[model samples]
Target: MGIKSFQGPRQKQTVEEIPLRVSDYMTKKLITFYSDQTIEEVISALIKHRISGGPVVNDKYELIGMISEGDCVKHISESRYHNSPMQDMRVKDRMIANVETIDGNMNIFDAANKFLSAKRRRFPIVENGRLVGQISQMDILKATIKLKSQNW
Candidate 1:
């Protein structure tokens, strides 16, 4: 006796191409601060740009550390408690020296995973040890949305 094979309906599979690199979604126009800059000045720039924090670069635009609102708050608290002037505080003293950075060529998915694991809201995108741009959680979300909206 011969058995007949059953055939199911053929389904079309679509593959979506996503922008793979962090550089694709990173913001090139960055608001960076210097280590020697006063905490007050850094806070002013952050408020003016409406940013939570930024990367601290040296004279050669090399990433050294990061300064954030949390750092500024700490400075404020210390100054208030000690009755010291906030103007004397510098970014280098308040900024995190061991900064975590990402490369521009890093995959977006990898960057997203890193963001999920870390408490940081953004990551500085560096190339050749130089600060080129910055990538945030929102940037990854925006890129994903754009990729999903594309016609397959």
Candidate 2:
């Protein structure tokens, strides 16, 4: 007599496409700053919004640089040392002019890797040289939580 197999017919596995792009988890509504704005104004906004940093843009809303609370603090220290008035300082003077940006279509995993490699807490998502949104470490963590429940 021939041996019988115990396995039954296998069913097709349907896996859901995970939403893992930078755009999928980025914050679209951003509180941006203008380069001409005074550092005091930036500091006020930062305090009001409870944010550490923000992107600096021109009149066209194109990203030009980034300003952070640390930048403002540095300005304060320098101004005190130089005997200069803090009211005269502008965001453009203390902002990080050389800014790095990421693509919106990039995978979130890759973005996390980027954040790790670059030692950045957030990355600006740009498309066609225009600021679209921003992705932060918290966003990546949120994505991770969502993916974890989906058998990631």
Best by TM-score: 2
Q: How many backbone clashes does candidate 1 have?
A: 0
Candidate 2 backbone clash number: 0
What TM-score should be assigned to candidate 2?
0.89
Q: Model 2, residue 59: displacement in angstroms?
A: 1.4
Q: Against the true structure, what is every candidate's RMSD? A: 4.9, 2.2
In lDDT terms, which candidate is top? 2
Whole-model lDDT for model 2 versus the true structure?
A: 0.91
- The TM-scores, one per candidate, come to 0.85, 0.89
Candidate 2 lDDT over residue span 31-90, tens digit each: 999988999999999999999899998888889999999999999999999999999988
Regions more than 4 Å wrong, model 2: 1-12
lDDT per model vs. reference: 0.90, 0.91
